[model samples]
Target: MYVSLNRNTSKWVVKKFEENHNHVLHLPEHSHLLKSHRMVSEAQAINIDIAADIGLSLKASHDLLSAQAGGKECLGFTREDQKNYLRTRRQRSLKFGESGALLGYFRNQAAQNPYFYYAVQLDKEDMITNIFWADHEMITDYALFGDSISFDTTFRTNKEYRPFALFAGFNHFRMTCIFGAALLYDETVESFEWLFKTFLHAMSGKKPITKGKRMQDNGTLIEPLNQTTEHLLSPKYSRSIIRID
Candidate 1:
């Protein structure tokens, strides 16, 4: 506010009552001064690419480049600029390597195992939907001590994000052993059913015999035992269902 006397009446009067509103936003010093690379030599660019391909650490690569430049500054460039360039180059290499590499690996593994059992489900377009496998050793273990099988589908790996299921059970040595595994694209009832059936088929229709069950029904649960020299019938399964027992 400002007060002054009128020129003709010689009286004091208020000129303005509101506070000053004019202001300007101020930035910090050197805000616009970005230290950027003005020029990168062709030899320096080539050295950077070579060091990155050899899997050198970013700091080490920068230090080597610095030493090559005779202790001179990076021609207005910073270490961060060189690091970003290396990262982009490495990512492009990984993208190209991922194409068809994983499937080829699986095929090679299948070829090496003569008695390897594998199943693949396809979609309407004939693309692989799901795949499962059990090796020869796994089948032998199943035939020997195939009781109390436990299956779990709680793992995922690789780019496809497929759920990996493992069929595990205890052996005669009282140690956990894997019988089979499956890579499923989705978690559905049909997928689970097919997985269980495939596991049973791989073991040559041999169901693990159950030993103990407290039943209220008068009917008996009989299990076939004709695998070896023992012809004795084994007691398996409950009166209500026809599951693994």
Candidate 2:
């Protein structure tokens, strides 16, 4: 019967038998009194879209709908149902590969601005390990106000726990402007050296006069930058560190 029985029919039979047994035992089946949740409608679908656009989470949207007068009874859907719908929509929207989605976004940006610069590094597995990008405006800003630049790598941006490093400088307007940014696979000396090289390459081999970076720890902070700075200060590079503290 496991393979031959219709699942819906078997469930119905079991439910009916239980109800009948409850009746025979003078027990009330409270199922009839329980409220049934309603299905989402077209209007609610539009509302969901708006809510998603506004960055509301599934649970937040569901709670918002439930709090409205007679909303839960009229909409009839629970938070889990909304969450399921959101998952379905997201899956459908991301029909292509996840990697393609990010690369496509960058491609679109480059299409709009021809001067956008970007570089990516892949691991041994050929998966994206690091990416560095800077726009033409940032390059222009760096040319004008690249005297003092700062580097900081204290944030983790993904599940891989990669450190996000930002190369920023102050513009003529005295505004903190980003020259370039990188995601390092690790905070090792090797990774930092590569990032510094890549960042210089992105900025057309222009090294900042004052390269200030936040010191997070005794070992990890200055050593990597110092090594890279020393390498760049070589006569071949024609770059020299005026001061180091």
Candidate 3:
């Protein structure tokens, strides 16, 4: 196709239009791969966000959507496209800096639900060293099933390489219930101490009768666990055990 500017009429006119293709055209089955045909719809975008929030990998989310849509050919977008979308969305979210955005999100949550609780631990330089949060559901769950709990912090899968900690327990039916969660800058004893203290405060000073935690060979968590046990139990409840796995 070709167009020319017509100075007399100040309008563009088609000078040449070729009806025949110069090269082999894409087959119908492959047409969906074309740039013009590829797009992530609003509904699909929402599903992607849901999947990401639930910790689904890009490939897994894409495959699930593909299956839902009957097949990849009908999914309207590629996995790379989904990844690019998430990358751009994350970049946009950090426009005000990651810490600012995180605090803003927490503020919004607290505004919507008074039971939402969160705490940020800072260093001498006033930079965030760790963060902990638990919603109303988690708080209520803790009150009901906080007798025995497990804490884990081995996850460091995000881009920042921060340790993601989760405080969880089982309900009466043996279903897992989350009491709280945190992101730590390091695995040091100080970080764990602050996290445990904040968690106890958030749960209204309710202590688990039996606490379970994974043991790290570095021995950094030993001091924190010992200190936490002293504060977590009364003289009569001293039999509470700190199970190490």
Candidate 4:
């Protein structure tokens, strides 16, 4: 999914080392920092909300995401662009060895700058969803009066391999996702359709906060979910919606 939430959340497991004199005997040589060269889900020993409380800024990033172009609920991806991006990433993944050192290096950067976050939530049935966030855009962009935001979402083929992400776009800036539906990724799109439909269905089930019974007749409601695309090199937040427990 590789939805670069933020530099910290991405490498939270152990990028560098900072220690106190706990004096707990036998702390391993690499104990203070991350050791494994493996990719892990966001839920691996980290809590998104707690990480936010400690100044890890995923929520802020999510907020900075633009809903300016949000019009309809599900503006899916253009097949050509998406197919190409994945093909390119896949080619790169193969060259570098899907699970190799380059990836590990990205996993251990230790600078404190404005970064983003993608939270992964789970349920008793162990279903999962992802949320993309950034502290805020590094730049300030204003929408003109009467400017509208286009909310768009894109679903790709099932994860036949390791790389799987859900993408949302605002305009030029897009959020690349890494987590959603958890193990649902393992299933073919045909089989896991129930999950995909459920997400699309989220927009179909909005609880109208203002108009009473306006959406009752259809028994369905949807809100615009805009994906803001930016020019900065900030990472993508194209994952699934954040489904809370």
The digit string of per-residue lDDT tens for model 3 on 1-245 reads: 89999999999999999999899999999988998999999999999999987888889999999999999999999898998788556544433356567788999999999999999886554556677899999999999998877677656746544578788878999998999988776677677678887898999988776634334424533444443543222112223223221
Candidate 3 off by > 4 Å: 1-97, 211-217, 224-245
Model 2 lDDT tens row, 1-245: 11244587774232222223333332234332233523566777778877877778677887787777355544566666676666455433333344346667778889999899887776554556556788898888878887676666666664334477776666767788887777565666566666766777877777666543333332554354443442212111222222122
TM-score of each: 0.44, 0.48, 0.52, 0.22
* Displacement of the residue 155 alpha carbon in candidate 4, Å: 3.5
lDDT score at residue 153, model 2, on the 0-100 scale: 65
Q: Which stretch of 10 consecutive residues in model 1 shows the poorest summed lDDT?
A: 225-234
Q: Model 1: per-residue lDDT, tens digit, 146-174? A: 75565555566544334787777788788
Residues 153-201 of candidate 4: C-alpha lDDT, one tens digit per residue = 3333323243233322232343322222222222233322343333333
List runs of model 4 lying over 4 Å from the truth: 1-111, 125-127, 135-147, 157-245
Q: What are the per-model C-alpha RMSD values against the true structure?
A: 19.8, 13.6, 14.2, 24.1
Worst 10 residues of 2 by lDDT: 231-240
Better of 1 and 2 by TM-score: 2
Using TM-score as the measure, the top candidate is 3
Query: Candidate 3, overall lDDT?
Result: 0.75
What's the residue-level lDDT of 115 in candidate 1? Answer: 82
Clashes of 2: 1
User: For model 1, what is the alpha-carbon lDDT of residue 54?
Assistant: 72
> What C-alpha lDDT, on a 0 to 100 scale, does residue 47 get in candidate 3?
99
